[model samples]
Target chain A: MKSSIEVHNLTTAYGGAPVLWDIDFQLPTGQIIGIIGPNGSGKTTLLKTIMGLLDPASGFVKVFDQPLDKVREKVAYVPQRESVDWDFPASVYDVVMMGRYRKYNLFKRTKDPDREIVLQSIEKVGLSEFKDRQISRLSGGQQQRVFVARALAQGADLYLMDEPFVGVDAATENSILNLLSEMKNEGKTVVIIHHDLQTVSDYFDYLLLLNTRLIARGTPAEVLTKENLTNAYGGQLTLLSKVVNLIKQNEFPIREKDSDV
Target chain B: MNDFWIILTASLVAINSALLGSFLVLRKMSMIGDAISHAVLPGIVVAYYFSEDKASIFLLLGATLTGVLTSLIIDFLSKKAKIQGDASIGITYTLLFAVGMIMISGWMQGNVDIDLDCVLYGDIALVNMDKVIVDGNLYVGPRAFYIEFLGFAIIGFCLWIGFKGFKLLSFNEDYARSLGIATGRWHYFLMGLVSLTTVVSFEVVGAVLVVGFLIIPAATAQLMTDKLKPMLLYACGFGILAVIIGYFTAVYFDVSITGSMVSVSTLIFLAITVLKRRKRQTKALLKSSTDLRG
Candidate 1:
């Protein structure tokens, strides 16, 4: 399998405090990959580093065997929903149209084919009716779908999402999951920073268990071992029940809507 | 003729600042407009000394550099030196403005044209006397008029070409960077525009009053709309209206023209804010009465 991302000894810091320490991973392509860890575990930091939004303090990261700048057009990023001001005066179509902008066509008018792609991306995320609606009027699930649609409009092969599932309804989650599966089927790679341990196995084929360092990286079943959990999760017993279910190895744990972190 | 020139010059100054101020307000950097206006005072003093002309292109360039410098210092102090954003801004502008003040009183003491009082309140009444000479005898127009007209053309062209990049930068800078856009280029380009607008409008509205023109009309429009395009349009319109109304009011009352204009803009802003709140309350009351009926 060709490598989608190769992080060789990446150490990133915010201000002076180093968050990620010597994270090394060469994730395979055409897989739904999840980066799982506790809060403040540098999951978002690593994702930002991969997106080239944050400069790593030490070591380097290569996407598709080249630097991020060399393959920037091939990458799409969906920031956390709370990262932007929801009250910003932009409609759903206006926000998604940002994806169609390129260096050559930035100053030119929005063409017909670009509009078609934006509409198709909106439809894929099930937001065709609310295309002209202002973003502030949308519900939490619909807001998340808007970001997904924007990323889809990029038509990039690699999608990097930061906690895309937080505060969204189950229906939105399933639809987004189906969309991710379809993307994977079309030979694209997706990397997500996820919080829900219950849906870990079902949502991702590749898992990167992280806690300031790369704890383990492989198939979800291979990476979710007891030893790996203890190393990354150190005294975080709140997730023990889900860990116990994984330890039992009987079946995949069903998602409890109320218990999501 | 003086009345027409004063009103035209003031309207031009108002619209120029309002157009750029729309972006500044949307970025939640309205205070930056205030900061940049004051911070460019020293640049104006320095450029005036070298060029010996207020409307010299060299002075515009020098002041724009200072404005961009102010932005860089604020970003550096906040991001690198770990100072709070408001503190850094306050520190930078006051320091630069004081330097400009010292240059005026210390060296340019006999120079009454660039006096501190004139720098603050400006002399719109005298703009008609300061004419642009074509061949040393033929007068063209007021210096402020030409300055603001050229500023308008430059600002309008940049806004047209950079509509996409600037919009993305205002909305989500990180997402814009992810699309291979150079966000730093747009950020500095905007800083440059703010600088240019403030420097040119200085002769018309003065340093402090330029911020009034920059923030008031844009803020007033913002209180009434939830879209960028209409907010900008309304801001430009409100600015012209304030210039016209304030021009007449100043003549009628024998008051300061620039002061009255900004004052009128504030009144408009306050009136709209109160009206919007009243409408919201009425809607809520109607909804409750309907709920009771149901």
Candidate 2:
């Protein structure tokens, strides 16, 4: 089986300082991979680099054995939910239709088939009822689902989502995860930038633990060991464990300084 | 009867500005439109100085070029100097406008006459004097009308054809770029269109008043709805309405028609905002009442 995405020595930066340093990874086709990291761990940067949103200072990113730009049609991206202005005057249907725009000629109107695909995508995301609703009126979960529906409308074989589960309710998150699993079953590679450690084992088949660089890449069981967790999280394992215990007890956990010096 | 023609011409100008303003508001580049309006004055003055005539096409072309150059300068300064977008626009427009005023006072003092007061507060009544005769048929209207009409058509066509791209680029440029859309190209293209419109309309509305024409109607529509197509249509409707009503008001009062039109637009904006606020309050009250009953 061939890898769907290959990033070798990828380093990206905004101006002079680098955001992602010496990142390397290979994602196989037809698998759901979770990219877990701390805040500013370059998870979004890695995804953006692979998607050709930002040019890597020195490295190569190949999608399906070709340059990312050449294989753009085969890849879909769902950016961070906060990247767009919800107040923008567009309906859910209008946003989904945008995914099909690249397939059409610049001067040509969207064809019937494109419209059908957009409708189907909306239906797939359980947003058919809200197709005509203005995007600003939808809740957070619904907005996230609308963007997912847009990616589905693209009909790409590979999807790169940045924090799709952020601020979403449990039901919406489960539905989105299920939809991603379904995509994997259909031989699509889905790479998601996920934050939760507890759901890592169940949600993804592969994991890429990153802390501004490649920490580990393997199955969840293989990479989520105590040693790898400590390396990626950096002395925060006790805090993570306490939070997990608090969640299990239905109480919020607050961290305090252990001034035992 | 002459007042009717004045109203008609103002209405056309309003319609053009409103349509173009819709996109400008959406992109949040309304200030750039404002800047181009002022910056084009130097171009017009220079062209008039060289041609020794006010009716030369060179003036229009030069104004359009300078409008585009003003946008580029703003973009460059914003990027290079790390200045805020609005600040860059302000600096560019003020400098260019000052230069234009100096040039008008120095070079074209006695040779060609272009009134600075008329440039600041347009002369719609005088539009009847600059008539173009086509095949011996007298078309009694300002030459500015034809230029603005052609500009509006081009802008309308561009907006109609590139509606989806513009929407995508405006709303989510990063996503658009990742989707293989050249969002930067579209941004520059939209700015170019805006500059073109500003140059053509400058002759009719002046510089400062064009800001009202570019931002007011769109803002009024924005207060009313959250749908792009309807917002644009409503803006055009509001603009035409303001122009008609303001022209008559100016005629009756013997005052500045441009000022009246802008004041009417501002009033419409305020009215919509108040009405929307009241409607929201009512909905909130009703929702709380239902919650209490439950």
Candidate 3:
């Protein structure tokens, strides 16, 4: 079990307050790992620190047994859909082509093979018809797909995503999960920051419950214990019950599907 | 010859502004250009008071330093002190601008050519009078021509080489950084470009209206096109067109050249906005008529 990410004693702060303090964990390679936490629980901060987008104040983050710069090309990140200005004047193809660009090819234009990869990435996400359409005209789900396509085009071994399913349609979410599973089958690792605890078992093979600190890390069944939920959620009744219900459904296995309520 | 120099100088300002201003506008730092332009005045006044020479190149050095400081102060206040971004910009520029105003008022009663009115609105028509005399007396073109052209050439070369880097930085900074590109370096490099451009353009449009040259044409081009490349080219074309119209308008009406140029740029922006509004209404009307027939 090769380690994909090893964060040790990492403390990242914005200015005065530390968002993530003394976070220590190692995620295994070739697994869909979800970092679940409430809002402002430093979920995004952890991903950013691992991607070397933020400087950790007190500790270090290692990727692939080396520093981030040494293995940056092997990592692809999909920032939150809300983080970017959707109104920017770029077509789907233009935006997807940004991932095909590496530091070595900064001065050179895209070659024919890279062009084919960009188009194939676009098609993989079912956006081939809207390749030339301006990104601002895209629906939220389509825009989310565009970002996934960008991350996919990087052809990286490790993918870090911040809330990729937020505000996406059912079909888009399903397609992205399928796409991510395909990547996992190819022996790539994906670490994602996700909300909605109900689907943790369905979506991720491994789980990390974060609350400015590492609360738990293991398989979904091991980490989703009632004791761990209460510890992480801090007596939040709604979230505790949601996980309780998830555990109940996992045991009973009677419902055909999760229909309304 | 005088008319050619004035229009050419203004066009150069237009081109320089568009080269860097497009990125600024997209980055949502358009007002920083306005703020830095206004804040460089104290540097100009202080440089003149110390050197006692208005033509000294140190005036540019002093003002450029002040322009860069204005942005740094804004960044410090907004990022470190928990201050709101807009309030930080407003606070930084006003303080520096007032300092410049105080310096100019005291120097105005003395035997100095640096006055408040001239600082606010520069006189571009006197460009021909400031000729660069070569080694012992061969008269070259206007000195402003050299400064403005140097600014344009340097900006063009940097943007051409770093186009992909800048494009990624402007569109998605986080993704760029994750790719191991130093986003902080490109950000400050652009700020330095904007600072240098503001200093060179400060003489032509003055401390107050330099933002007009940097912002208005880029904004107008943004309205005319959605793509960045076309936006840049359209900005250049719109700026040159504005210079021609504004130069002729100034000559016929006997007004300020810089004033007329900015006013013309603003007018073009307004005209396009109105045309776009009407086009939207027409599209809606056509859709409604077809729906009614069905």
Candidate 4:
């Protein structure tokens, strides 16, 4: 079977400074893959480069073994929650309907079948009741789900999401993961930029560890080793473990004072 | 009465401005319109210098070119210079407008028919003076009206055809690009349309008050609706309403027509904001009371 995504020597930059360097990865079809890295570790950049949001400085990216533009209709992208203006004059339904725009002619209006798909997508995300609500009025999780519903409405074979779990409640995160599992069961590929390391193994079948470059890529059990974790996190594991311990103790982590007294 | 014509013309101006303004307001680029309106002055001056006539097609072309150039310069400064978008706009128009004023006041020396007063306060009353006679009948009410009408049609058609693209680009530029949409091209196209609209409407409402027409009605509609289509429709409705009321008020009080129209829009915006705030507070209070009883 052909890979769902292929990248060879993929390098991306903003204003001539490299953000993603020498990225080479092949994601097979019908699997849930989690990407984890530190902040500014080119995780989002990799996703954006793959989705064709940012042009690569050099090298190439192919989706379904074809150029991205030619296969745009076969791919769905769930952008970062903060990338969109919440105050924009659009309801949840209107936003979902936008996913169908690529399927129709430039001048053609969205028809009943499009509306039905949008409704079904909303239902899948468990937001059918709030379909008419203003996007700004939604909570962080609902907003994230709205973006997922938009991707679902596109009915693409491949879905790429960036930080879908950020600021989301546990229940909403579970539902999102469950929805991704359902998509995977139906032979759809789901690539997500995830942040939490503890849930990485439980949530994803495959893992792509990155730190401004490719650190490792394999099954979660093979890729989430201590050495790979250290390389991807860069000595922050101790600090992160302490913070996690504080949370387990039902206390917030204390910060060191900047001024030495 | 001639008052009816005045009201009708004002309404038309309002509708045109409001329709285009919705997109501008949503993009949070309202100040760009303000900048283009001011920067077009230099173009007008250059055109008059070359043609020695305000009615020449050269003047319109010059103005449109300068308007588009102003937008491009602002965009370049914001992108290349790393300046904030608002600061770039502010600096660009201020410099261009200063040059325009200097050219008019210092070089022309009040000799040319176009002056500072005309740039600041347009002559809407004189719109009826020039009429088009076709087959021994007055067909076009005024040259200014026809120009504005043509502008309205062009902007309306462009926005209608490009509605999906505009919506996608404005709301999430990255998503639009990922979908293989050329966001930069759409951005420039929208900027071009804005400049065109600013030039066409310059003769009717003057430069200063064009910002009022472009911002206030759409902002008011934003407070009332969360859908793009309704927001645009309501903004147009609100703008026309304000224009009619402002025209009558201007006539009755003998005030500046443009000033009256802007003031009317501002008033409507304030009213809607306050009303929405009150409604939200009431809803919150009711919900709190219900929770307490439960």
Interface RMSD of each: 1.1, 1.5, 1.0, 1.8
Judge candidate 4 at residue B64 and give its lDDT. 79
- Which sections of candidate 3 miss by over 4 Å? A239-261, B42-62, B98-113, B132-140, B292-294
Clashing residue pairs, candidate 4? none
On residues B162-181, what C-alpha lDDT tens digit does candidate 1 reach at each position?
A: 88878889998889888888
- TM-scores of all candidate predictions against the true structure: 0.93, 0.91, 0.88, 0.89
lDDT of 2 by residue, A10-80 (tens): 89876577878898878889999999986567888888888887778999999998998898898999998
lDDT of 3 by residue, B36-147 (tens): 8888878877777778755566876787788888888998998789798899999999999998887777645474567777677876888788887899788778888888
Q: lDDT of each prediction vs. the true structure?
A: 0.89, 0.83, 0.85, 0.83
Q: Which residue pairs does candidate 2 place in steric collision? A: none
Instruction: Please give the ranking of all candidate structures by lDDT, highest first, separated by commas.
Output: 1, 3, 4, 2
Worst 10 contiguous positions by lDDT, candidate 2 chain B: B138-147
> Which parts of model 2 have CA positions greater than 4 angstroms off?
A235-261, B49-58, B107-115, B134-139
Clashes of each: 0, 0, 0, 0
lDDT for model 4, please.
0.83
Give the Å shift of residue A35 in candidate 2: 1.3
Candidate 3 Cα deviation (angstroms), residue B33: 0.4
Evaluate residue B130 in candidate 4 and report its C-alpha lDDT on the 0 to 100 scale.
62
What DockQ do the predictions score, one after another? 0.60, 0.55, 0.60, 0.55
